[model samples]
Target: MDEMTCPKCGSSMTSRTLGAVTVNRCPSCSGVFLDRADLADLVEAENDWHRHTGPLTEPLPRITADMTAPPPSRPKARSYIETLFD
Candidate 1:
């Protein structure tokens, strides 16, 4: 299973809502990962304590087999829904 692990520290992160933004925040480091879609809101939010490490315009790309493992010997077929979703 995929875990929302913090990059700054190896702590397990929890979801938090700052105004209208939902992000993964590390309690140990007080660092948060913002959803790209929510960044505009983050900028306009009333709070002024937040700082971002880098651009948070989008969430991390989903890790597929191509990223984590060697390619298969042959191409695998995609499901109907997978095709539609992709």
Candidate 2:
């Protein structure tokens, strides 16, 4: 395993392999330490994994404008039967 130092805090970093890509993570700062090329490689590997896993599940449908439109407003109501009782 290669040794790497954290760029932010200068703390020693540990190497880890997530999925198929290798990354260096900082211990003290809890920050991921990866070079530009390593970051790109990690993203590419993740995308490749997703591609092989097939398409993701469809997202839930969102409320449309028609569904969200407010109902028609009406004037104050008066009951004829109530008026007769009164």
Candidate 3:
């Protein structure tokens, strides 16, 4: 495939395939780009994942002042580009 340049940063972008869909991603800014067919494929892939994984959240625990838990430490947030390929 020919190298594609990022429209936002002018850096070279890399191609990644998720199932039958191929997307271009910018390494510098973590941007994702997809064509119409790829977008449709990605949407279908997301729906399939949701059908298998069910809801992503769990039931909230009982809330009380004394029982309050410390704020959960967050990991570095991943971009949608990273998520789509994973």
lDDT of 2 by residue, 1-86 (tens): 55678889999988766544556768798886666877787667656555666546998778776676568896422432112112
- Two-way lDDT contest, 2 vs 3, winner: 3
Assess every candidate by TM-score: 0.42, 0.48, 0.60
Top-lDDT candidate index: 3
Q: Give the alpha carbon lDDT tens digit for every residue of 31-60 in model 3.
A: 888899989877777676656664469898
lDDT at residue 25 of model 2 (Cα atoms): 69
After the best TM-score superposition of candidate 2, give how far the Cα of residue 49 lies from its true spot, in angstroms: 1.1
lDDT of each residue in 1-86, candidate 1, tens digit only: 36788898899988756456776778799786877888776655423423322345877778876787656785432321122112
Q: What do the candidate models score in CA lDDT, each in turn?
A: 0.60, 0.62, 0.76
Off by over 4 Å in 3: 55-86
Q: What is the TM-score ranking, best to worst?
A: 3, 2, 1
Residue pairs with clashing backbones, model 3: none
Candidate 1 vs candidate 3: the TM-score winner is: 3
Give the Cα error of residue 64 in candidate 3, in Å: 32
Q: Best TM-score goes to which candidate? A: 3
